[model samples]
Target: MAARGEVSTGVSADSEPEPGWLPDAAIVLSGGRGSRLGGTPKGRVRVGDIPLLDGVLDAVSAAGIQRAVVVGHPPSLERAGVVVTREDPPFAGPLAGVAAGLLALPDLPGKAWVMVLACDLPRAGEVIPLLLTGSPAEDDGAGVARERVQGADGWLVVDDAGRRQWLAGCYRIGPLRAACAAASTEGPDGLVGLPLRAAFGRLHLREVPDPHGASADVDTPEDLMRARAAARRSHRERMES
Candidate 1:
């Protein structure tokens, strides 16, 4: 997209125009079945004495995500007022959830920034807005943040041991939609591993390893405990600061 952190209106810096005052919009990816956690809806799992999804919603709201749509089953998503959805055809995991969000398009309530975030993250505060860093304007349908890492699998930025989380990622509506459309034609299974790597290799894109501390996500019970400890430490540090 537009140069990392360097925003404008159009695709290029010079073409960047004034953006419309978008209200605020988002997509909470709550469609996972948490198969690794014994089919438990990870979004509904409690953490920090609150439902995991609640922790995520709090961050999105904190970052100004006023109008949001959730993707998941009703029983799995008890969060009120969140417009819920499901994985579109081909049911190709999280990508479909994101596609459903992109399909919502300009129709999103308030017509604002359509951010997509997952519920299993350790913290969502810092990374919420960091996703919008590459945005040219508030409504130019721009921006995308590379999850940040230190190696070539650098794409494996926030992986815990081996699980490569993707839904926790975010992107602006423009390039995101293009990516989805391209993925759709080739079918779902073709978007990961070698194929996925090749797809990203062909884009005229910018990679930013600027993920915030909140980017970490927990999968196992041990991971959960670590996340809680981390959160507690962060709170203590913030208060002291």
Candidate 2:
């Protein structure tokens, strides 16, 4: 088992705050099987003029996350540009990919927030700031877990709300690493899904408005179409600006 907590690059957080934001790096989880797309690599799919991973990387860039660690599957990781890695055990699922990312860059010297992202999202780029802002630091190794309202209210809130989107989470790598390692027992089911919850029951989750960008993913062809339209709209706004 490869210790996924090894940091070997410049992605580490520095002692001084470059600007006003907490220095951090994004560990994008892009190794999932786009089952609805006939097993196509969602990261390669075009969302507007750029590939899915491009949009994700841009989002991380905009958030002041200078460095990125992409954990993709097979040739998907072979893409040119940016720092990329692959799943430790190939297609073992998103958890495996996430673990690979955590391992690839451990002890980010200056970074505090490790934004975990999925590649199938169409609007994640526009919606990540909301999660990064106002999020509390995990003074302890627990982490900043989001909680929402009651389950009956729906599965979106950030608090201990009977609802939450575990995948679209951010945290300090220390606790997250320990939690993930402990959750390894659950295999793919662990990590950002159920096992993560089990390991860190007392996580510090914050609640947002349940932005669709953080929740929606391009799974099926219909989803792709929707994502394309959204992406085009965003691109147009940027071009006009």
Candidate 3:
């Protein structure tokens, strides 16, 4: 955790994972103010005909994860068919949403790997599966160095520019829960006010490179427009070829 959207490197993945290895759950954060897009809920915004959140959820489902927690306003998540939760006092920020989402899951053992994603990733369906490929298991004994915990703890995808995308990573539930618990102690509002970077710094994280450039998340009006254009372009390309 450097700052929000800051890049940090040093951790690396081990050998390829066993066949059929995948996360057991996903936590999709949908609670953004959309201040750059006129205060609209980013989850509710449509890139084409599909809502941004829907696309992300579809990707999660396609990746063989049935258990998902969507943290956002109830109204926006009503029909998503996943656990819809919200951070207390609302608009607390991404870390608070992560806490809320973690709280929504049932207590179960070995369901350690959890995929964390943002609602605005238009290409989530394709990108998420790619991220899951060749992931290291928690028991790999990769050892921690320079604050980087190898194996099971989790790996996040970095963009082409080698920037780590905190919201677009997979994490181990045990460490994630512990981090949330520790971050909750900071203020009367609990984890709601915690910056994601500050909270995640507590975990041992590695980075995966995103060569396909599918981790783009819509944050501004221009981003929305680009998403729409990309969707249309993809559709046209598919129809033509």
Candidate 4:
């Protein structure tokens, strides 16, 4: 574990096998104003003993992504390679946070992909493999194969309720940069308060289904309780195994 403000490069000992494809960098959006949670920073909210932000960081590290920029306030993280930053003007929405995170990341090839994650998810690590591998097969009666979206701008996760979780997607860096640039010029606020849908509207995206509810995020006290319960269940399952 890293001390406050220190960097760590250690990978999770229990991390699953590395996928054939991995994002070169990750952008973690953590700047939301947890209004529903009584002004508490969601990143600092613990799902069990681990802070939500740390849990998200662990997921990123477990995926073998060395470079990550966390945009918002987060507790001291155990992983060394993670960078902590904030959106310009503070409280600027997730779009601004993504732009800030991109700026914080070292330059990489245009073809390199970046994982964009929101820091409120408890089971974020479980979805990484699904995003990396490709979209999940459609649930039609016929058995289908999971196919990668070639030349697509990115892969976005569709939660169990069929809503797209834009912040949980993996994207090609080039298109993402272009989208951010275009989005910055859209209004006087630049990326501030910009909706993620508008920013990535032009890019083609493959929808990956979240069958395991991995994209579920904490938004309220009730949500947090559910997350805590889920975490306890996971812990028990592990212990039993």
Candidate 5:
């Protein structure tokens, strides 16, 4: 991994190169206030012994994304190749965090794609590959090829309950930058307090199904308990296997 805000060759010499369809970079939105969790920083909150932010970063690294910007003050500041930044005024909103992350990322080609993730998701490791490769079980016979649909701005995860998880999506950089620019103009406060849907509404996004509830995020204490329980169950299953 490269140093913070520095660009890298992406794949290490010992590692296999990522598929062409995978994202070139990532923007993690971790600056939320986590008010429901008694003001604890969601990124620092532990999901089974691991910090939520570290878990998310590990997933992103495993996905072969070398360039990433984490938008928030996480407990671990010096993640290799990942830049940590805070949104202006801090805790403005997810949209503001997205903007900050985007700004922090190094420039990429027009065709490049970036994964936008939230730090509170315990299942991010399982969720990311689904975002990059359309789920075979949910596809209409097109399989993973559905991910390359022409002119589509990106793919957003539709959780089991049918709600679109905007922060869990992967987007083409050009369209996302355009959306951010348009969003910035909408309010004197810039992207602050702007809803993600209002910013990204114009883009042509495909809905990918989250078959395993992988898009579930930790918000309240109950959500955290559920995540920890799920993590323990996964660990037990892996050990048995």
Candidate 6:
């Protein structure tokens, strides 16, 4: 597994394999201070007419995900067909959000695959199929349990710039639960302040390339502007087609 914040370059090409099943649910992490955006929740921020949360939910829905947990308390997201919940103590970070998501699930044991995404990305939905398609190969080990335990767990997107987007991925539920458990114990806030890379260290990951930049997300006013412009362009293209 890759260390916290380390960009991995050596994940074997042989690990890529076709998905055997569709994702059962999604955990959309939405509880961030958006401190750079001056305390505005990124999920509530708009790129054109749609809030970021709506866009993410739309993508999740489009991917055929029946259930979704938005790990934040945005009224808009609750109305967007997601189960809205917040990390304990509020703003406990993405790892804690993951823990909350797992707990909120009614049948965590029944789910085989769960998509995990950040709420800030306008195009977050577009990358989900890529994650689903780039699952770990069966030959990686003799058994599913053996492969995952040996670190072949899930699929994460690597952006065009070659940075790993931890929030834009799909994970096997059992391994994800284990990883979240390990990650949540690393901090006082139930992994509230722990960086994503640390949590990622607990799993074996396969990198799915983000060829269309679908993992691009808003972190600042300038990013919002760009996202809106891109949304406009995409809308225009769709209308023209």
In the order shown, the candidates' Cα RMSDs to the true structure are 7.9, 8.5, 7.9, 6.8, 5.3, 8.0
lDDT of 3 by residue, 72-163 (tens): 86343544437888888689899988888888865633335678999989999877866656332332443222222335467787888987
lDDT of 1 by residue, 1-86 (tens): 32322322222222222232222456777766777767778787766677778788887666544566776653544444466777
Residue 116 lDDT (model 6)? 88
Itemize residue pairs with steric clashes in candidate 6: 92-192, 151-204
In the range 1-241, model 6's lDDT, one tens digit per residue, is 4332222222232343223445667888888888898888878887869888888888777766667888886754344446888888797777778878888875656325677889898876577666644423443432222243234567688888989898888677777788777877777766767887767768877676677788888888898889999989989999999
Candidates by TM-score, descending order:
5, 4, 3, 6, 2, 1
- Give candidate 2's TM-score: 0.68
The predicted structure with the larger TM-score, 3 or 5, is 5
Model 4: CA > 4 A from native: 1-19, 138-147
TM-scores, one per candidate: 0.64, 0.68, 0.82, 0.85, 0.87, 0.80
Global lDDT of each candidate = 0.52, 0.58, 0.73, 0.77, 0.79, 0.71
Best by TM-score: 5
Residue 120 shift from truth in candidate 1, angstroms: 1.1
| Candidate 2 lDDT (Cα, 0 to 1) | 0.58
Q: What clash count does candidate 6 reach?
A: 2
Candidate 3 regions off by >4 Å?
1-16, 74-81, 134-152
Q: In candidate 4, residue 43 scores what lDDT?
A: 91
- At residue 240, give the lDDT of candidate 5: 100
Model 2 bad stretches (over 4 Å): 1-19, 74-81, 109-111, 134-163, 186-202, 211-214, 234-241
Query: How does residue 192 of candidate 1 score in lDDT?
Result: 27
Look at candidate 1 and tell me the lDDT of residue 154: 14
- Across residues 143-214, which tens digit of lDDT does each residue of candidate 2 receive? 222232111111112433335555566555665676667777765544544433554444444445443445
